[model samples]
Target chain A: MPSFDLDSYLQTQVERVEQLLRSRSDEMGVQVPPRLLESMRYSLLAGGKRLRPVLCLAFAEAVLKQSNVPRMVEDCACALEFIHTYSLVHDDLPSMDNDDMRRGRPTNHKVYGEAMAILAGDSLLTDAFALVAGGPEPVRGVLCRELAVASGSSGMVGGQVLDIAEDRPAHIDYLTRMHRLKTGALIRAACRMGVLAAGGDADALARADVYGDSVGLAFQIADDVLDVTGDASSMGKPVGADAAAGRFTFPAVLGLEESKQLAARKVAEAIDAVKTLEPHDGPLAALARYSVERRS
Target chain B: MPSFDLDSYLQTQVERVEQLLRSRSDEMGVQVPPRLLESMRYSLLAGGKRLRPVLCLAFAEAVLKQSNVPRMVEDCACALEFIHTYSLVHDDLPSMDNDDMRRGRPTNHKVYGEAMAILAGDSLLTDAFALVAGGPEPVRGVLCRELAVASGSSGMVGGQVLDIAEDRPAHIDYLTRMHRLKTGALIRAACRMGVLAAGGDADALARADVYGDSVGLAFQIADDVLDVTGDASSMGKPVGADAAAGRFTFPAVLGLEESKQLAARKVAEAIDAVKTLEPHDGPLAALARYSVERRS
Candidate 1:
């Protein structure tokens, strides 16, 4: 097992983010859509690792150890998860994955119908910006530019759009492009924005971003491995679902042995990326190893 | 039968918007998602009366005759239409209206998958900010503030969210609340933003907002009327679909007779609201009358 205490790190960040999302989100006149807000909250607070935002906060704090970093980081962090979960919600809809199960429950659309699911995704994505716009003005532009690029066409949206449309035979470059934009953008943003929020730690942020990119890619590759070898009972979700969907996964293209070698390479790269950072973020370095090496 | 030439006006705006949309929306670096951009363009260029953005620009030019407005005004105008069309695209998705037909073609999700459709909506919506953010510093703040409110929870997204989850029988207040937020907020922004972009007289901007509120409500009322009476063939969508969806609409609560009366009253108010502004923009006042009274 990796030596990282990410679970504890996640616990503290989740509490902080929950408070931030609740206190900061209220507006003066508009009554928030209760169901939408409730649904978003349920997904966000639903006991996941809180990896994305925690990584963001950790990366930001690694170099510029200020008290205000956590104070200012929640909206951006939670908003990343909101966008991620929202995509998951819509992606699982019948027209796409048609999966009834997610994190061991029927997906939101299955419970709420398609319109609410669609709108939930829409609301979550927009609420992300609204959250950023409401943040302190200094970092607002940087956050907007990064998050928008990550979430919009150039990043996650672009990758997913191509994922849906592309019937071409699998290529690493194409899949890597998709992975970096779709899954990796927000992950990388979490680190980069964290550093930015800490009031300009460019070197630390760049290092964090390297860690993020390598880990994000390794995370995907590990999932492809898990889908190939993971047991359905232990995986929570079905195993081999990606293969069933005819997805061009790492193991499918590279063979399991090659995929494992690539995963190991990425884990080393992710760990090495942040070697220059001080020992205070030792847990984060361990996280890089866990990302590629985890079985479930 | 309305005095103004609605078809020709709509045609002119649509042509201009289509021309603009075909060009790349200038972003700092991230490549525009090919499918998302293509989908946005497909819907943006899809036929609709460019009333919202037209109102924005026409009033802007009418109010601020300072001769300093940049071509970005045209882009802002195009941006409003993009926002409106994006909402419609998402609203028409299977998870929402589940309608296959929109403007006589397949709805975006019907053509693109649900994930891409959601992203396309998200892309277009956020891209509106990118458009406004590109403007001069003076106007960007006003543009950002106004667009954020209109597009965010207090405005369109909030209303649509409520409309989807209201779980109520057809109720007048619910319908009004939904319409005001879902449709009226953006309409109000269209008028308000036009004046803001032009740096128009403050009083004129307020009056234009009043005009927008009235015309916007009247437009909804007319849509409700069309829901009962329009030819699906000519309307290019399912006319009685609202009733089928169990949605609370103006005509359902007001009764057809009362709904028509209310629409006419609102149209008169719209005309009255804009009449304060003199010879500079006779066309806008004329257009409001035409927008609510159009048979198609």
Candidate 2:
């Protein structure tokens, strides 16, 4: 009867993710060197939108038509977050993006030395598998495969390579392909993993896959738009760095107006795809809209 | 009727691992960017002893008492090699060990650039899980857990942190613990994963564990001895770099004679532990001896 307040939903879910990450770090065992653990916790616990984990949990809830999803869903969500954090840590390294600031604070390498940051990222990536491997059988292997395939050379890492390539073509198709692999792959995995974790049927999984594809592209377009138009304070990192570095983004490839229109259309597709899974004005629809409308 | 020839056994296993690595890279999908795939293949196909994969396959054969292990065993073996290769790539990074050469060739970064090399290492690590996750259901999860835990924060990465720590204690216990995690964990996993993939019983797994622990320690001590006494051409990498960097190695902590004695003792322990798992003069015992006798 009441309206589904997306803000409150996100806050509650973010808190849950934070708690899980904290507990998981604590449970990493006494044998985990203190400094390595500290470096890992620093970026892992650093505040972000928690987009991947939230999307994973949301899909699970929507598929089950209930809020109380299984522990497998939580495990999948945590693994997604861990993978996301590791990517960020590595992407921000001096040899990569050379990012000095992230999430309104100094990057991992700035706080911990570059070597420790690399190890922290490595530990996070490895530990994500450890966490998912502990999930209940049948689905656990699926979860591991999903997470790995989405993040490995053919996916996120592939996207990174394209992004940094000196001879990349400047075309909308190339841009789309790059984003699809880099950011879209993991986002899609998050949604699909949620469905798998909740034992959703084939139809549900297919719908989730469609919804994820749309939202993932939309999210990257929105990110490109924000880099051009949004303020640095809200984003926690400098704006326009992508353009300055001559990075191929939607706004750069297409006109700003065209990019915005494409994002809006993609969001609409995302919402329509998830209609069977949730009500018209449900969190899924709201999230699609938020993908483009969010300031940071 | 023929003697267990360690040389021929290693050559045959190494070839199998190399073939798998090549095929796996080819099948990573065309969606994978060319540069990323090239970088990944560079270090992955680069010749080493293929020790981890060979060890994994050997244990699987020893447990099954046949040369024809399952596809799962091969998959786990490749995964182990992938992890080992990734660790080497990262360890050779400028921010980490800063080595310009590895396996008698230019390091990954030298060929592919630093950013590409990092991504290559990352892709290798993530794809390792993907490889194992494709194994048969229940055992796949266990394989994932074993590989992850052995290579994660509480294992190899943790050991790396200790190795690089500025204030690390200079004691035998500290050195042992560091090696136990960094090198020993993956070696132990190599043995255990082989047994699991072969569907060996718990007792077999336990024996593999003991054998792994002893050989792992012996391997490190031998490595330390090699660094101090072995030739660079034979070892592929420069010798005495560890001592030059003031690394806490066996030869540095204990005297050279004491380190050699300790290695011999560990090799004896390793051979003794595996007597129940393999014939008295089997490949397992030969491998234990090889752990100390190898030039590289």
Candidate 3:
């Protein structure tokens, strides 16, 4: 297997995702309300790990047997980012988590007011489908279906509903199910979309699906751990928010040590799942491990 | 032109739409949170004119030269209604219009609480695309793109932003543009999607586009006029909401008499635009006239 530098790979792809998002927002500037566009840009352009888009592009590259990302791959990546960003924006609304800060800056609603924030989130979600629909016709329907299913009622939004209804501590089974729908669905969809965009065979998609599911669960566990262990300044938001909100979390259900152990086990399983892709999947393997180990 | 029973036609199709919507909601009930599903069902199954879905099916019937509505056409129609209903739910949030009632009952947020209402709206909007993505492959991409563009920032959401920003009475041009994006875009898309679903040729689609545009503008003008002239009991919501909200409106910009006159002229133009469809389009013509003439 060829040596892979995960940091460099992420940095390069994150830049591409950022540039595409910025340009797309600019393209929409003239057509949308100035404040609405500004609110969208504020949240979309705000810095994050860009993990979903990177996972999308990386999977596409692996499936296509190419070193360079294809144009359609970038479009799919941007769509994933848009959906993820919109979810975050809506999650931070006063009616939801009511967070004032994200990425160490004021949330979209805090800056643009509640109405514009809601509209901005709505725009981002709608534009995501529009972006995917603009891709090659052969895969447009597939991509659209993947995105819509992952982000819609039975997926992200349903998870949100479950989360908000959590007035008491939840069982491990309930927490797992909630996280699978809320966070795992989008992550898994991002992986599947990359393979679909590349027209990869069913076997390749199956492998990617397993890899995504394992990694998604591991990622949430790691997030839960970080919320307990990390500092507010480093996390770019208040630490222990889950505890403060009295929300169900991995660490809450399984103690911190057990949560860490479970996350490690899931990451190992994710890496093993992707081993079939071998030489071309170095970045993916690295990503799975990074999910559980990342400080932020 | 063959005599058309607009009332009976609307009655039967609306029944079909209501049944489909109910079944789909039930199908989703198992997967979604109970409260969230209730909120979505509350708004989606609520009684309304069902005009958008009806327009969609009518155009498809005309284009296909068939008396029966195809399943995909009905699917597209339902998707249009879903988008429209979601917008109304979100728009009624305290952060937005703060409306307490809609369709002669409490609004979603008023009944289900703010967080669940927001999730319900988000789920509905996302599911609209999911529903379209399930349509026939040949038209799925086209339908998805049209719906997304019509409902996205550059369309409905953009119009909403413009609407919310109106602290003072807006000029005619600004108000026109706002209504075009807010209300007109989805109406126009409903007509276009109907043609697209039927695999109508370019000429048919072009003619439908013009018909939709004229009717859409007329519909909004009529709505503005009704806000001033109609009763709350019949309209299903309080009248003069625009005035109470201090928002820019067609009547505010054009005055009641001029707005009424413009709506009549547009309805005439809309009827003229669909004349090429002739005998099969009688229902459509009546719908155009009704846009300006309906009591609610």
Best by TM-score: 2
Off by over 4 Å in 2: A1-3, B1-3
- Candidate 1 scores a chain A TM-score of 0.90
Residue-level error in angstroms, candidate 3, position A105:
0.3
Provide the clash count, candidate 1: 4
Candidate scoring better on lDDT of 2 and 3: 2
Residue A27, candidate 2: alpha-carbon lDDT = 85
- Judged by lDDT relative to the true structure, which candidate is superior, 1 or 2? 2
Query: Candidate 2: TM-score?
Result: 0.98
Identify the leading candidate in terms of lDDT: 2
Q: Which lDDT tens digits does candidate 1 get at residues A1-296?
A: 35558667656766876666556554422476777666655555555556687777777667665435645576677667767877788677776667888776778877777777777676666667666656665566567557766776677767777677767458888778888877887788887877776775667777877888888888888888999898876677899899888988888888899998988998888778787774634767767876876667
TM-score of chain B of each: 0.91, 0.97, 0.96
Isolated chain A TM-score, each model? 0.90, 0.97, 0.96
User: lDDT of each model, Cα atoms only?
Assistant: 0.74, 0.91, 0.88
B189 in model 3: Cα distance from truth in Å? 0.2
| Candidate 1 backbone collisions, by pair | A114-B95, A115-B95, A115-B96, B94-B98
List the lowest-lDDT window of 10 residues for candidate 1 chain B: B21-30
What is the DockQ (computed on Cα atoms) for candidate 2? 0.85
Which residue pairs does candidate 3 place in steric collision?
none
